[model samples]
Target: MNLTLKIWRQKNANDKGKMVDYKVNDISPDMSFLEMLDVLNEQLINKDEEPVAFDHDCREGICGMCSLYINGEAHGPDRGITTCQLHMRMFKDGDTIYIEPFRAKAFPVVKDLIVDRSSFDRIQHAGGFISVNTSGNTIDANAIPVNKHDADKAFEAATCIGCGACVATCKNSSAMLFVGAKVSQFALLPQGQIEATDRVLNMVKQMDEEGFGNCTNTGACEVECPKGISLENIARMNTEYLKASLKG
Candidate 1:
C-alpha cells in the first residue's frame, strides 16, 4: 500500500509549524500506524533527512504515550484505540493521511507529532492519589466492605489511563472528564473519602491554572476516550466539587 501523509512539523514550541507532505510506499495493511511511521522514518534517515518525532512507549496502548490527532480525530479513525494500536488496514492505498500533535495550549508541540504533556502530570500530582499507611502488616482486602455497586463504579472510573484524549477531543479542551474520572475513582470508595474535599478542590484549581478550558457538556471527550470513560464521571465530579466547596 502507498499513502501520502501531510504531517505537522515543528522544531520547537516557539517555532512556526506547517503541514509537510511525504509519500510512503509498500506499507503493509497489517502494519500498525506507528510501524508505518517507523518505515517512513527509516527512509528519511537513509536520505539524511530529519525523522518525524512522535511519542510511544509499550506500543501496546497501556502507556497512553501514543497521543495523536489523526485526520481530525483524536486517535485516527478507530474508536476506543490509540494511535499505536491503529492498523494501516483501516485506510486504503493512495489515501492521504493527516497527522498532528494534540492541539491545546497546555499541550504545546515540542516537535513533530510530539507535545509536552507534563501539564497532565502536574494536574495529577495536585491530587490524584490516596494516602495510605505503608506499614508492613497486610490488612484483609475486604476489611472495609464497600457496597458492591459503588466498588464496581469506582473500578470503572479507575480504568482511565490519563491519555488526555478527552482534552484533545473537547471543543474547549476541558480536562473535566479526565479529572472527573480520577475524582470519581476515589470519591465512591471509602479509601478516598478522608481527603476527598481537599483533593477535589486542589485538583480542580490546578486544572484551571493549567490553562485547560471548562466543560460545556459537549460529550466529545467521553466519545474519544479510548478507555470509554463516561460523561457520568463528569456529573459525579460536579457533585464532589460542590460538596467540597460547601464544606469549606
Candidate 2:
C-alpha cells in the first residue's frame, strides 16, 4: 500500500511547529502503525535526514504511551485502542494520514510527536495512593469483604492509562476523566477511607495547578478513552469533592 503522511514536526516546545509531508510506499497492511513509522524513520536515517520522533513503548496497548492524533481522532481511526495498536489495515492503500501529537495545555510538545506528560505523574503523586501501615502486621485483603459491584466499578476505573486522550478529545482539554478514574480507584476501597477528604482535595488541586481545563460534561473524553473509562467516575469524584467540602 502507498500512503501519504502529513505529520507535525516540532524541534522543541520553543520552536515553531509545522506539518511536514512524506510518502511511504509498499506498506504492509499487517504492520502496526509504529512499525510503519519505523520504516519511514529508517528511510530518513538512510538519507541522513533527521528521523521523525514519536512516542511508543510496549506496543501492546497497555502503557498508553502512544498518543497520536491521526486524522483528527485520538489514537487514529480505531476504537478502544492506542496509537501503537493501530494497523495500516484500518486505512486504505492511498489514504492520507494526518498525524499529530495529543494537544492540551497541560501537555507541552517536546519534539515531533512526544509531549511532556509528567503532569500526570505529578497529579498521581498528589493523591492517587492509599495509606497503609506496613510497619508490623499485615491485614489480609480478603478479611474485609467489599461489595462485588463496587469492586468491579473500581477495577473499571483503574483501567485508565493516563494517555491524555480524555484531555485531547475534549474541546475544553479537561483532565476530569483522568483525575476521576484515579479518584474512583481509591474511593471505592476500604483502605482509601482514611484520607478521602484530603485525597480528592489535593488531587483536584494538583489537576488545576497542572493547567488542565475544567470539564463541562461534553462526554468527548469518555468517547475517545481507549480503556472505555466511564464518565461515572467523574460524577463519583464530584460527589466525593462536594461531600468533602461540606465536611469542612
Candidate 3:
C-alpha cells in the first residue's frame, strides 16, 4: 500500500508546530502502526532528513506511552486499542492519514508527536498509592477476604494505563475517567481504605491544579479509552470525593 501521512512536527515545546506531509509505499498490512512509522523514519534517515519524534515504549500496548490523535480520533478509528496496537490494515491503499499529538492543556506538545504527560505522574503521586506498614509485619493480601464482586470491579479499574486518550477525547479535556479509575481501584479494596478520604481529595485537587477541564459527562473519555475504563468509575469517584468532603 502507498499512504500519505500528514503528521505534526515541532522542534520543541516553544516552537509553533505544523502538519508536514510525506508518503510511504509498499507498507505491509501486517505491520503495527509504530512499525509503519519506523519504516518512514528509516526512509527519512537515508535521505539525511530528521525523523519524526513519537513516544513509544513496549509496543505491546501495555505501556500507554504511544499516545496519538489519528484522523481526529484519540487512537485512530479503532476501538479499545493504543496507537502501537493499531494495524496498517485498518487503512486502505492511497489513504491519507492525519496524525497528531494528543491535545490537552495539561499535555503540552513536546516535539513532533510527543507531549508532556508528566502531569499524570504528578497527579498519581498526589494520592494514587496506599500507606503501607513495611515493618516486616505486613499482612498477606489474600488473607483480607475481599468480596468477589468488589474485587473484580477493583481489578477492572486498576487496568488504566495512564494514557492521555481520556483527556484528548474529552471535549472538556477532563481527567475524571482516569482519576475515577484510580480512586475506584483503591476504594474497592481493603488495603486502600486507610487512605480513602485523603486519596480522593488530594488527587482531585492535583488534577485541577494541572489545568485539566471539568467533566460534563459527555462519555467520550470512556469511549476512547484503550482499556475500556468504565464511566461508572467517575460516578464512584464523585461519591468518594463527596463523602471525603463531608468527613473533613
Candidate 4:
C-alpha cells in the first residue's frame, strides 16, 4: 500500500507548526502503525531529512506511549485501539493520512508529533496512590474480603494506562475519565478505603490545577479510551467528591 502522510512538524514548542507532506510506498498491511512510521523515518533518514518524532514503547500496546492523532481521530479510525495496535490494513492504498500529536493545553507540542505529557504525571502524583506501610508482611493477601463485584470493577478501572486519549478526544479536554478511573480503582478496593476521601479530593483538585477542562458527559472520552474505562467511574468520582465535600 502507498500513503500520503500530512504530518505536523514543529522545531520546538514555540515554533510555528504545520502539516508537512510526505509519501510512503509499498507499505505492508501487516505492519503496525508505528512500524509504518519507522519505515517512513528510515526513508527520511536516507534522504537526509529530519524524521518525524513520535512516542512509542512496548509496541504491544501495553505502554500507552504511542500517542498520535491520525486522520482526525484520537488513535485513528479504529475503536478501542491504540496507535501501536493500529495497522496499515485499516487504510487503503493512496490514502492521505493527517497525523498530529495529542492536542490539549496541558500537552503542548514539544516538536513534530511529540508533546510533553509530564502534566499527567504531576496529576497522578497528587493523589493517585495509597499510603500503606511498607513494613514486611503487614497483612495477609486474603485479609481483606472484598466483594467479587467490587474487585472486578476495581480491576477494570485499574486497566487505565493514562494515555491521555480521553483528553484529546474530549471537546473540553477533560481528564475526568482518567482521574475517575484512578480514583475508582482504589476506592473500590479495601486497601484504598483508608485514604478514599483524600485521594479523590486531591486528585480532582490536581486535575483542575493542571488546566484540564470539565467533563461535559459527551462520552467522547470513554469511547476514545483504549482501555474502555466506563463513564460509571466518573459518576463514582462525583459521588465521592460530593461525600467528601459534605463530610468536610
Candidate 5:
C-alpha cells in the first residue's frame, strides 16, 4: 500500500507546531499502526531527516501510552482500541492519514505526538488509592465478601488506562469521565469505603485544578474511551460527590 501521512511536528513545547506530509510505500496490511510509523521513521532516517516523534510503549494496547488523534477521531476510525492496536489494514491504499497529538488544555503538546500527561498522574495521586495496614496485621483482601454485580462493575471501572482520549474527544475537554472511573473503582469496594468521602472530593478538586473543562453530558468521552468505560461511572461519581458534600 502507498500512503500519505500528514503528521504534526514540533521541536519543543514552546515551538509552534505544524503538520508535515510524507509518503510511505509497500506498507503491509498486517503491520500495526506504530509499525507503519516505524517504517516512516526508517525512511526519514535514511534520508538524514529527523524522524517523527510519537508516544508508544507496550504496543499491546494495555499501557495506553500510544495516544493519537487520527482523522479527527481520538484513536483513529476504529472503535474500542488504542492507537497502537490500530492496524494498517484499516486504511486503504493511497489514503491520506492525518495524525496529530491528543489536544486538550490539560494535555499541552510536548513534541510532535507527545503531550504532558503528568496531569493524570497528579490527579491519581490526589486520591486513587486505598489505605492499607502494612505492619503485618493486614487483613486478607479475599476474606472480604463483595457483591458479585458490584465487583464486576468495579473491575470494569478499574480498566481505565488514564489515556487522554476522553479529554481529547470531549468538546469541553472535561475529565469527569476519567475521574468518575477512578472514583467508581474504589467506591464500589469495601476497602475503599474508609476514604470514600475524601476520595471523590479530592480527585474532583484535583481534576478542576488541572484546567480541565466541565462535563456537559455530551457522552463523547465514553464513546471514544478505548476501554469502553461506562457513563454510569460518571453518574455514580456524581452521587458519591453529592453524599460527600452533604456529610461535610
Candidate 6:
C-alpha cells in the first residue's frame, strides 16, 4: 500500500519545528510501524537527505522507546500496544498519517520524533528503589509470604515501561499512572516497606519538580498505556501519598 506521511521535523530542541510531507509505497500489512519508518528513512538516505530521528530498541515492544503521537493518538490508533508493536495493516492505502513526538512540558522535543524523557529518570531516581543490606544478611525470599492478590497486583504495576504515553495522552500531561506504577510495585511488597514513606514523598516531589501535570481523572493514560497499567495503581498511589503526607 502507498501512504502519505506528515511527520514533524525539527533539527534541534530550539528550532521551531513543522510537519514535512513524504510518501511511501508498497508497504506491507505485516510490517510493524517502526519498520515502515525504517523504510521511510532508507528512502531519505537514498536521496542524500537526512534521515528522520526516532527512538527504538527491542522493537518487540518491551523497551518502550518507540514513542510517537500518531494521527493525534498516542502510539497510533491502537489500544494496549506501543508504536513498535503497531502494524501497517491498521492504515489503508493512500492514507495520510501524521506522526509527531509525545508532547509534554517535561518532555521537550529533542529532534523530530525524539523528546527528552529523562524527566522520568529523575522522578524514578528520586525514590524508585528499595534499600537493602548488602553485607549478605538479607532475609530469605521464601521466608516472608505475600498475599496472592497483592502479589499479582504488584506484578501488574511493575509492567510499566516508563514510555510516557500516559503523559502524552493526558490532557494535563500527568505522570500519575507511571509514577503510581513505580510506587505500587514497591508499596505492595514487604521488601519495600522500609522506604515507603520517603519513596512516595520524594518521587512525587520530583514529578512535580520536573513540570509534570496533575492528574484530573481523565483516564486516558490507562487506555493508551502499552502495559495496561491500571488506574487502580493511581488510586493506590494516592492512598499511599496521603498516608505518607499525614505521617510525615
lDDT of 1 by residue, 1-248 (tens): 99999999998888999999999999999999999999999999999999999999989878999988999999889999888999999999999999999989988889988998898888889999987766987666589999999999999999998888999989999999999999999999998999999999999999999999999999999889998999999999999999999998
Best-to-worst order by lDDT is 3, 6, 5, 2, 1, 4
lDDT per residue (tens digit) for residues 1-248 in model 6: 99999999999999999999999999999999999999999999999999999999998889989899999999999899999999999999999999999999999999999999999999999999987676989868669899999899999999999999999999999999999999999999998898999999999999999999999998999989999999999999999999999999
List model 2 lDDT by residue over 138-229, tens digit each: 77878988889989998999999999999988999899999999999989988788899999999999999999998999998888899999
User: Would you estimate the TM-scores of all the predictions?
Assistant: 0.97, 0.97, 0.98, 0.97, 0.98, 0.97
What RMSD, rounded to one decimal, does every model reach? 1.1, 1.1, 0.9, 1.0, 0.9, 1.1
Output the better candidate (5/6) by lDDT.
Answer: 6
Judged by whole-model lDDT over C-alpha atoms, candidate 3 comes out at 0.96
Compose the digit string of candidate 4's lDDT tens values, residues 61-83.
78889899999889898988899
- Which pairs clash (backbone N, Cα, C closer than 3 Å) in model 4? none
How displaced is residue 2 in candidate 6, in Å? 0.6
The local lDDT score (0 to 100) that residue 138 gets in candidate 1 is 63
Single out the weakest 10-residue window by summed lDDT for candidate 1.
Answer: 132-141
Local lDDT at 149 for model 3:
100
Give the per-residue Cα lDDT of candidate 2 at 154.
88
Model 5 stretches with alpha carbons more than 4 Å out = none
TM accuracy, model 5 = 0.98
lDDT of 4 at 245: 82
lDDT of each: 0.92, 0.93, 0.96, 0.92, 0.94, 0.95
Error of 3 at 20 (Å): 0.5
List clash counts for every candidate, in order.
Answer: 0, 0, 0, 0, 0, 0
Better of 4 and 6 by lDDT: 6
